[model samples]
Target: MYLHLTGTHLRLLGSMHLFPTTSRRTPPWIAEAYDWADTLVFESDPPTILPLLSANEQGSADRLRPFLPPDAWQHLNAVWPAGGSLAPLAGLRPWAAMIVAPTLFQQVVEGVEPRLLRSALTQGKPYQYLETAEEVAASLDTIPLDAIGAALALLMTDLAEPQRTLERMHAAWLEGDLPAIHRIALESPMFNLPGIREAILDARNRAWAARLTSLLARPERTLVVVGALHLCGPNNLLDCLAHPFEPVPDDAA
Candidate 1:
């Protein structure tokens, strides 16, 4: 079964059931998928690539410094000194910086993926990754620095807001609302950048579709989880798979 952010939120909500319920919520399909799967395939990088990327990212920091506007550069340096290897804003390529900014924002707001990964471990389900960190990083690197700069500028502004965008996304995921997910995804600032849609979404979707096809040839029931955005629109993974896609059941949530 192919799951998306719903799986992430479900895993999180499932894990949290051990503690206080609080405000956590999950769609029914996520639970259904988790129960049915014999193996779990995570749409993530291999474990070993993160540390290597961190080391290499700092070396590109000086290269990116000249591209930031004077005010943006000053603000970034003030917030994150260049001397720090993992300084959030400094010493990173534009694409890497763009990726990091939203990640940090999501951290503050809380995310489903971390909790979901924890649940997978606790369940002792065998897990596999879809790509290496090097491959993922290389794809992001294909994005032009100018495009990344534009994305970063918009991101900085969005960060100042109350993050209504994230709230909408989370709500949609919890409700298994695909239309809302597609709408929000299409309207994202990232789509405004040239080649980004193709590089990050379409191309990756095609690659994943091929991988998933190979997995399907095996007899073992597998649960595939990826970002919610990759499941919508033309040439999306679901479409590329040539499967008859169905909308989430109204009662599923």
Candidate 2:
């Protein structure tokens, strides 16, 4: 995933937000990319630690108890036991819950971006992000509550389904299978929801491409890491960029 530019040093890495548990350490290829780059770019800063929700909080299960029907509430509690690891989700907004749930459910390790971010923090390697917090919030808000509810319901009812899809995506990414990556990303529940593709993936890809366009003008060798999904399907980040990017080839040496 190292993007090559003559007379400039810029690498684009498609990152997995959560790595399979089997991958406990940074892959050598990723380490090489980090070693070569003087600067780094990411989708966003690591989010702030989530605070425990108070009883009066709108998104808390305490408030949701009265709003959802008895059977619905029962199902929620049953699916995510109060003492279970998933219990914290009950305190998050639907959007936040949707994002965190898969990672919580998975047997995973710190992923590509997080691993790099940690190293950057330890070494004091400077970095920046494509979008601000508000822009991310605005994009996430476009996903209807019903869409989030249905997606969550899918996760609850058929736990194996999401796990299978995640496995497929991870495998595709590992193998550098672009078509499979695009297919899996487009077919994922959240992306498949109505109008969500345009709002979440397409818009953000365009915006990120614009930012990278600006960043490429600078002198430093930089590494850019984002979700693997954003680099494929229609209107991918590279395609949206003002100029095309070329990938560095591995030699027989």
Candidate 3:
């Protein structure tokens, strides 16, 4: 799957399975797309981490305390427990930890792309990446630290709204509703920060679009899995590709 660097959509896609419930059922087009593919392509380089948290880093959680809403703060403490250090989050890069903490507080499961990678390996499907981990990190670095902090504060202060938005986005994805996905992308908080939107989405989309075109030149059937967000909006990867692949209807599966 062409994954967004953050693995957000990875979780959404990976959770989809058809048998039990639609909540996580694999969207019909995704399953159908994969069924004929012999190769898988990812959007980023291999994953790695930078030291954003460490046991010795004092006031880690304290820095965020003032920004967190009462309920969010309560959830944070519930995860880390009071009087305990922020050691559990020490291994993650600061940005990663920031992204993860809110999801954990909200009890959302993520990292579906990594699981897909493992499955591809086990099934002996060849795979390639469009960008390296270093490149992805560098793009993230372009977003000012203050912006990151502000985004985190927004996440903490109004948790419910974001969660609801995500639910809607997930539903749109499952239905293969590209227009809905595009609408959400335009409204997403990331778009509020022009620098970040350019770095993380636009630039990467352009690069991936080029790579995807090259891959399409090959004779083998390829399954391209990417973050749903990348496929939406004007100038997005989907728009950039010479041949657009439409999603099959859920009922058509």
Candidate 4:
């Protein structure tokens, strides 16, 4: 989805982190926004958050297994036949595992955030992150162990469904069907867990909105690319923005 500040050279893009390689071409609107902006913004920096994603102790798979249902562990291995990506799980907290599982879908090209970051570096466009690594870690720490176990159980059960869900989400994202993206995403096992929706989505949206309000005072033409959910669903970032902005089909007027 696309949004423009009602009366300034500011733009917002509801970014899908990953897309199927078959559709590897960048969307026109995204390129337009990238070209228009003097600076860009994203959710958080990945490398800075890597440490927080790891557990204090190693052998996370062995440690996590006791808490997970037997069938879920069986299914997790079944889904991860190679154990290439699975190795990362051995040291990750459940919440971190959830974040890492996005590639479980299949045949995804590089995620848009990384691609844009690379471009920003190559072309000399300055950029910034909405949340620091510490902030992201704090948000994730809200997840209790019991909820993690429940989420892992559902994540393993019928992995095929998650694959299909990702495809459906990608399609909706390409079509700019904001409502469809929000509905499909919220249906995930993680979101359904107690208190997770607030911890992961709503609270972050509020925090991002506050950061973005200050950003509005900057003179640079800007493009902010955050997750699609942050721009769509109820209690979304756009709605929380203290400054007025409106969706625009093209460039900001």
Candidate 5:
């Protein structure tokens, strides 16, 4: 799941998280650019190419393997960077940076320690939980009218479960539930234009676009990395480009 934050807010948040840690394992580029930037942009679908060095040196798998899922590792093998060695990061130099969305946080947490979930649950009722197919089918049973008052109370308060709802929507999206995301969002009164997940994505795109627009106007060289999807569609940076860029066919390789 992507941690959506405003560009400026993201920089501030990332800085706070990194300040006390001295671990040097992950590439320095992430923290370096993140800290120095006037804006820190995040995307729902950030690019995530594997580090070739990590793959080639089989011994490093014990360390790197923990960070990626098995499926991602398989893909890494298929695209293992060769010859040029550091070709995976070519064109991206000292100042150029890339950001990957936070996808495996849940999986990593669950895999490492099942207790994390129990702890979160102990806090209170989880904001929301998805109805399984069995649960959906079971809805055929009628609800007692007595529970309706409590349900309506939840809809009116800030204490109403939001994190649970967000998780459900995220799960739905990941499972190819395009309609479910929209359905859940529309059904919940708590989520809306300025505060909903979609609104957060929209704000993130506009924030990064404005930053790039200002920087590109200068003579300085800048490389802003965002999700591949954001760069391709009608709302893409390509549309905003003054010069045209041709598409390179995948088969041409």
Candidate 6:
């Protein structure tokens, strides 16, 4: 969910469902702020639900575009003058290389899937408590029944808003709306699963904190791309920084 961006100009998109974080429209001051930062870092995480493409025999870069946001297409088209003004706003001409960490990829591929899993204890039998991973694993004959059971217990509750927030994040990014992106991050549904939500939040906070620590060590001002969700909660990345920076609100977009 973190990235290292080095260039004269940069645009980073953070997304979470739908909410207006900025004033009501894109503000000129935000663009001016980017000009002052010198190094533009975007902290965001792409949603993991997007499917990965199967590798080709030659492996000539298969496109996972379909699994990406609809706005990416627009942004790609806007790089030119008539389409939009991202180039001027960035101040960096052709743009430098963009670095991204597919954190969501790791989470989705490695995380457990609860609905598809089956319990070994007869379906009709009622078992109230399924606490630990091993207890769930013992009840089934699968790759990792316990893990899936535990993960499902967390992912199944109130996921609609989180997922939508992710989608909205992508949309705002494509449209070059950082403020709107921030709104989505702050207002997305509460991730309050008994055994899962807090764990996920804590894990995310550690990951982002680590990134900030590393960035603080680096001399170059770099732009970081990560998930919008990582920006909120108690220990937010911006909050952890030694220096000061302002969050672009959704209304500004």
Report per-prediction Cα RMSD to one decimal.
5.6, 3.7, 6.8, 2.7, 23.2, 20.8
Of candidates 6 and 3, the better by TM-score: 3
Q: Write the number of the candidate with greater lDDT, choosing between 2 and 5.
A: 2
Give a tens-digit lDDT track for model 3, residues 1-253: 2222221111112222112122544444555555556776766544343343331233333444455455755654556523333345433344454545545434344433565677778888887777877677666555554555556656656666555666776777666676786687566554564565677678888877677655555665556666767766767776675453433344532
Better of 4 and 5 by lDDT: 4
Q: How does candidate 6 fare on TM-score?
A: 0.32
lDDT, candidate 3, equals 0.54
Residue range 46-70, candidate 5, lDDT tens digits: 1122232222222222233343455
- Cα lDDT, model 5, residue 163: 43
Question: Cα lDDT of all candidates, in order?
Answer: 0.58, 0.69, 0.54, 0.76, 0.31, 0.34
Query: Which of the numbered candidates is closest to the native, going by highest TM-score?
Result: 4
State residue 88's C-alpha deviation in candidate 3, in Å.
7.4
Error of 3 at 105 (Å): 3.1
Between which residue pairs do clashes occur in model 3?
1-225, 2-225, 2-226, 16-24, 16-26, 17-24, 17-25, 17-26, 45-131
- Model 1: weakest 10-residue lDDT segment is 11-20
lDDT of 5 at 157: 43
1-253, model 6: which lDDT tens digit per residue? Answer: 2222332132233432222333123224333333333344432212221111112232211122242243542343343233222232123111110101112111121111121112213243211211233322222211222232323223234334444555566566556565676576456322332322334344445555555555555554334434455455555554554344444454432
- With a 3 Å backbone cut-off (N, CA, C), the pairs that clash in candidate 5 are 128-164
Please give the lDDT score at residue 141 for candidate 1: 69
Per-candidate TM-scores read 0.77, 0.82, 0.69, 0.88, 0.24, 0.32
Clashes of 4: 0
The TM-score ranking, best first, is: 4, 2, 1, 3, 6, 5
**Candidate 1: C-alpha lDDT:** 0.58
Q: Which regions in candidate 2 have their CA more than 4 angstroms from the true location?
A: 5-8, 49-73, 81-91, 251-253
The candidate maximizing lDDT is: 4
Error of 4 at 102 (Å): 4.8
Q: Model 6 misses residue 106 by how many Å?
A: 19
